[model samples]
Target: MPKSVAGGTKWTYFASSNAQNSRSPEVLFDLLVSCSSEQGFSQVAYGALTDAEPTRRPEYLPAAVTVNFPSAWRERYAERRYNAIDPVVRRTTMQSAPFLWDQLAHKYQLQPGEMRVLNEAKEAGLKHGVTVPLFGPFGQLSVVSFASSFDDVDPEYRLSRLNALAWQSHHTFAEIAPSSEGKCHMKVALSEREKDCLRWVEEGKSSCEIGVILRVSENTVNFHLKNAMRKLETNSRTHCLAKAIRPGLI
Candidate 1:
């Protein structure tokens, strides 16, 4: 049964049974649509970015995308290459957090161009929205957005429920999505030195401190950490530590 949040919005938490049914992209998208509708959102979109470089322009037509937005709006967004300027997309690369569109102006100093994108979206009937950003193991990024035409929705409750749904959608899609050239199954074997550096990093040690403990130069410690990141296909030290710890590699 769906639970009702404040202001009578029905929030559907995806149960394990529901997850089992969402094995295909079509089923996953349908689940998003149904959940969005139940929560008073008029549209839902899911996009995956193989390259999440904030400075680079994303492909106008993303390779992995599904949406229930209007065709005309979609055309406009693509034609204008709005993804490159969209504050939401930029924010996704900077953090792994779910946020409401209405909060963007408060959290970020919106440039004129970014503000224009938001205005155009509202003109196209996407007045309010929540977005969930998911980071992948190999520097990929996936985002799910639920948008509404009205402004009266409860932000806190809806964001919490939709955040759960977005994560479930990401995991289910990852399981069924095609892997390219064994990328998904590749083993990440860290060298002993790399493991040692990552273990020290996990304990909140600085590169200089790790160098002293390992009896190596700070630059050498950094080199091993970078090698570990390359093997793990992560971009940052924090992400590398998380990837290493998750599989008990360190």
Candidate 2:
């Protein structure tokens, strides 16, 4: 059968459903991971799958880490530092929702540098991939992705299945994985304004932009952020985000 058109009502349905219920990241990831088979894909990973806790600083695992993508591939990608050139990772860092191959493939023309990386991925049998970068309500950045060997696949069907599975995956993981690092031991409470400010920050908004959006002065925005930082007991905005996510304050 011919591949279904990607930009259509079917795709809209998936997008709408995902937007309506996004309370759980684990459920979303699990759903994406489980849909690999039906979507004609293989392997899926969200968040750092590494148990290789650092030695001297055993507590150095950042709240944000690369998800699945074979150990060997990761090493090679790092050795060559392909991540800087991998447009998917770079672009997805800025988006809140999931993204399919076509969106990236079409949005940015593959420059020579990008083509080389794409060819490398293709050679490794990763022809198509979908990435969902979840910026947690707190400052966590978790990426869930599915890879496949097929190009020009039926996106409508794949998205339909992916959409169906994302919620359940998000819910299950959140329930089992608590908001805090110790799961239950670390609890940081934020005021409503603090939560609001941190959530927008995680989405990559600046104080000025957030002020405009929230109809508050930039100083007011900064005040909320400052209060959030004080409550979270973090030094910088990035650390504040990480701490918020680690403790599930947002």
**lDDT by residue for model 2 (182-248), tens:** 1224456788877777667655568998898789999998998998777665545544654555333
Local accuracy by lDDT, each model: 0.68, 0.54
What clash pairs does model 1 have? none
What ranges in model 2 sit over 4 Å off?
1-34, 48-72, 109-111, 178-250
TM-score of structure candidate 1 = 0.60
> What's the TM for model 2?
0.48
Residue 185, model 1: Cα distance from true site in angstroms: 11
Q: Which one wins on TM-score?
A: 1
Cα displacement (Å) at residue 11, model 2: 22
TM-scores of the models, in the order given? 0.60, 0.48
Error of 1 at 182 (Å): 14
